[model samples]
Target: MANPNQEIKFTKLFIKNEFVDAVSKKTFPVSNPANEKLVANVAEGDKADVDLAVVAARNAFCRGSVWRNTDPTARGTLLNKLAALVERDSDIIANLIVLENGKTFANAKVEISRFAQILKFYAGFVDKYYGKTIPVDGPIFTYTRKEAIGVVGAILPWNFPVIMLAYKLAPAIAAGCTIIVKAAEQTPLSALYIAALSKEVGFPDGVINVINGFGPTVGHAIVSHLDIRKVAFTGSTDVGRLIMKTAADSNIKKVSLELGGKSPLVIFEDVDIDEAAMVAHNAIFMNHGQVCFAASRHYVHEKIYDEFVKRSAALASMRKVGDPFDADTDQGPQIDEESMKKILHFVDLGKEQGAKLETGGKRIGTEGYFMEPTVFSNVTDDMSIATHEIFGPVQCIIKFKTVDEVIESANRTNYGLMAGVMTKNIDTALTFANAVEAGTVWVNCYSAGAVAAPFGGYKESGIGRELGEEGLSLYLETKTVAIKLPYKN
Candidate 1:
């Protein structure tokens, strides 16, 4: 039933399972970054729209509502139904993602495929989520109950739209919480389409809502609203800080953020140079280097530095950079012109600060926002590229002498999202993995995460985890209930 050739269009705000226009009757153009052409004119939601969405979510989360009082197994069943619908429309969703986000068609399909798996993963937790019984003294029985944390406000990023939506929405819904999602203005089509699919799947009214607009107006309203009990955001660290501040200043709402990363990949001299080169190339160049946990910082042992750089450069040159919808394309344009300009600025800074440009440091074509897959050698910690979170296709390779030295150098930056170590010796691999300051460390691998495993950051990268059992806990609150029984003879 999934039709890859079906034409899809969404041009309104989806609130309370209904498509409606904005209160001000204003609209903004959604452009296809692949060709820099107009896709649709979307309703521009503001604070007024956010207010209505929050109210709907609050009502749905109330004590006697259909959503809040539903049986746990029934809730799981509904989630499974939603997953089935996602599977049925995966092709359409993937094509819409390609049209708006500019990721290669294969990558878009991969993201869409994960939607069902993620939803089912969380759905399994619906009845399994339990609290422990405690032994108390005398005539009292004590235990704790895990309850849903009222209304959630989810703010998604432009990159990986449908996957991120599954990460936030699936867990929240499984935990019996209503949500008001604010899709990134740059890529709102796929999320709106998925919302429509949810309505077809028969979710209760006011259970799932979505709106599109600028961050300052729509996003700010979601974080600052007093009725919103929890706020989950995935974006830049600067904006994450603003959300935290807004939450604290308003009503002290619970917050979870998955922010930026400047993760490092360490390669030892013992491994096969060919395999290391391939992994290193895929780590940074897989998603046009736009991934949060991308191994942008490469720390190679001095013995294999030259050979690794050579192989990586050769692969970069062979990459197919063109339109996203093309099946053969390996790389596509950046999200927009602003992102292209920012990435180019960092490329210039890397050169000015004395790093050697190895290959692919300029724009690819005259149209769209495509940039060359860039690599820089002789990069030191002091360089601008090495110090900042360059969310683009720019790799910085630094040479190191020992595990201790590389560990210190890799932990020098403020980010601690993810780090990778590739080696054959168990002691060496475990040593580096233990020494690094990151939330998740990969040994002999990179950027391969699962829905069953918890993923998040350490320091500035984020506040809480997003997947696995821990992810479900983020949407739930525990309350201790003690009942006093009549004294027995």
Candidate 2:
């Protein structure tokens, strides 16, 4: 029988479809962010370990039969199989995610389901990938062929570990590229579970490897590895810039970054106050407000500002905070104490700047990294929380008079990953959607995304898209092969 309190130890790393001890033999404890308790022990891989994984992935891409020569239909079939496997083990994955990442169990299950959905979506597109032949003037025939970029390196964040994992992995596999993933140190169990499932689904040895360790060590190593042909990263803008620099210095590998955001939610006066207020509540509180696209900044029309603030504050105070495993828990603790401190620091800065805290600007209880769902009114665009990616359950509300001012405030941030507009007017909705400098604009909705549509950041939020045909392109390289026509013009 396993020890109840002791975390299960994963002494080996996943490489070549099997578990092997890390070459460096370093190890680290995986802790539950909710209570700061150990949940598991994962190999702490570094440069040498990353090199080994990269070589394994490169061989899998270049010499192995797993993906390089697989037919598109066959590739799709494998991805479909993987999706089914994920669905079957959704509960297990969700439990692990909650245990380590501190997200509510309900939200974790939804994330798992979303992961499966993305896998299925990529599977659908695998068979649909086609090379186009363009009709050109004269005897010249122009054609394009898409081929896999080998040995993709995927660096995931801890916030939505498994879901983000699916976002990067599914499309890469569908495009016939072997991948090596570095899971966030804060969460590693789900990645291990995913590795186990990959073997069960018959992905060949070395095709998909998962490494767990610190970013500077494992992440940098993977990004700088010569064998890595591409890098797909989801993290902070600072880290994204570092990865870009590393990739540039070592190799001209393709880089895809989905970075941070201080997304805005615009609530026009024409919208239903009740409906808009409720929508805005979910916008800032979902996932404990740890979402990259969480509507952290709110721009409300002055006409309904008082009512909106009142309703939004009431909803924030009503959120149930407890262990992530509890079904009744609406929100869990921040990822860890460090993150909790960072969030509180931002909240303090909000106070220092003279922003009025309507409610919830302090930690909730002493048991965990539990922060009260905070809301700040009278916030200026210049406030740090108003401009930075707080990545917490803090909502900053700002009032605006005109549509043009609202648009300007919404677009003022350096990050433009997503923005929300709560307006019943179709004309206003369309106008905001068109004018907002964001990759995704939600009308009376927040964080609404599907695999059919492409997702990315417009400015510093990110480089490269993550879903649909555009996402798949990140994993593929275009090859134009031509031969002289039988009869020249």
Candidate 3:
């Protein structure tokens, strides 16, 4: 473990452009996953704190309020200012992420950069988003009014805290909606820091509120708050379901969920075995396999199965797992002990269910929550490791015989967030691309998504899109307007 002694600021709840203690006056300790050491004790918010945030957000979203009456182009300009601030402080944000989320320092920087890009992308759409004019029958003139959907409750995830926050906040701002951000329990400090940045960039008071707390209290409050017009979430499917129920039970607010994924990556017999194997390795191993669209299940054609597994195991074994700040370290620790133990349980399940472990399945030194990049071969579709969403650095490689067979195998799982098909054959690539049930499909790549592309999931994976032009629509409402003109004047 490397030294992570950076000074922490803004550990209190950010509401109405001010930082304050939680209503309950409780605090939770945030620790460095890399070293298993306490970083800061953040203000632990409860339902009361959430209520305060909701009040602030609703006030900001009120008709004739500064936020509600702000021009679309002005909103875009404000977003640009925030994006510039984020870019300028990318290193500091990346440092916080590395200390909290255990993301590799380099990758954390990349994630921060992507967050800026996403902000700018949504910024570009602010003034451009519009409703269409519809042709009407007889003497009627019909059109639609595109308007903001009022206050939004954004419940973020821990894996990529800032990046996922970008997915929700950027679009909400673009649509001229105020937001109450519930930072994930594990990684709250960065969100608070960003909230400060948002205020510093001249956003109106109460336009953006962020709080830190557990999912049961603060998250529930945000989801069930009646005044909030929409809720955007990025987390597990189980919690997403609860949010849906809570929203329905409260005010029937609009919701968009980007949920869990056990995505599949297919390797055809035609591609170069080594290069393809590395791509598969990086797909699963990146971010310690904590990505929602991580290629956890790799399907290799039988012809190249042996070589692929050999190369994959070798690569997994060689992956350097250590301090995230170290330039050479390839992987970091799990977020916490509970997450680490859960991952170990899945590894045990892999071994017990007759799947052969080729490389790693054990924890590293006991100081931190570090684990080896474990690879499993001879995995079947029915195994627990293959069926469950093990958000860790565990890769399960299964053998397949044909295109139809692989496609069926891929679709067998309940998740359909993203899928990858690597092949030189255009026909095979196109077929797999068309057949896959995922929201996003990459023909020759894995996890290479752009800000302009719509991203979400299918089935249990999730309910709505989170990026591209579709993202802005999630925070907006369309009101139909029909005027009957004097008959032919």
**Could you give candidate 1's per-residue lDDT for residues 1-489 as a string of tens digits?**
223344756779888889999999899988888788887789999999999998888888888898888888777887888888887877788888887888988898889889889999988999888888898888888899999998999999998898899999999999999999999998889999989988998888899999999899999999999999999999999999999999999999999999999999999999999999889999998888889999999999999999888888888888889978877889998999999999999999999999999998998777788989998999998899998888899988999999889999999988899999999999999998888989999999887899999999989999999999999999999999998989843
**Reference-based lDDT, each prediction:** 0.90, 0.87, 0.92
lDDT of 3 by residue, 1-489 (tens): 234666787799999999999998999999999888888999999999988888898889888898888888999999999989998888788889998899888998888888999999998998888888899778888999899999999999999999999999999999998999998989998898899999899999999999899899899888888888899999999999999999999999999999999999999999988889989999999999888999999999999999999999999999999999998999999899998999999999999999999999999998989999999999999999999999999999999999999999999988899999999999999999999999999888898899999999999999989889998899989999999898753
Candidate 3 Cα errors over 4 Å, as ranges: 1-3
* lDDT (10s digit) by residue, model 2, range 1-489: 111242443446898888877777778887777777777777888888888888788877785355677788887888888889988977777778887888987888889889888988898888777688987776777899888888899999999998899989999999999999998998888888888888898887788999888998999899898888899999999999999999999987889999999898999988898888888888889989898989899899999999999988998888888877777889998988888999999999999998999999989777668899999999999989898888999989999998888898899889999988988789989998999999999988887787888999989999999988899999989888666676867
lDDT score, residue 191, model 1?
94
Winner by TM-score = 3
Q: Is candidate 1 or candidate 2 better by TM-score?
A: 1
TM-score, per-candidate, Cα-based: 0.98, 0.96, 0.98
RMSD for all candidates, in order, please: 1.5, 2.1, 1.3
**What would you estimate as the lDDT of candidate 3?**
0.92
Ten contiguous residues with the weakest lDDT in model 3: 1-10
Error of 3 at 101 (Å): 1.0
Candidate 1 lDDT: 0.90
- Residue ranges of candidate 1 with Cα displaced over 4 Å: 1-6
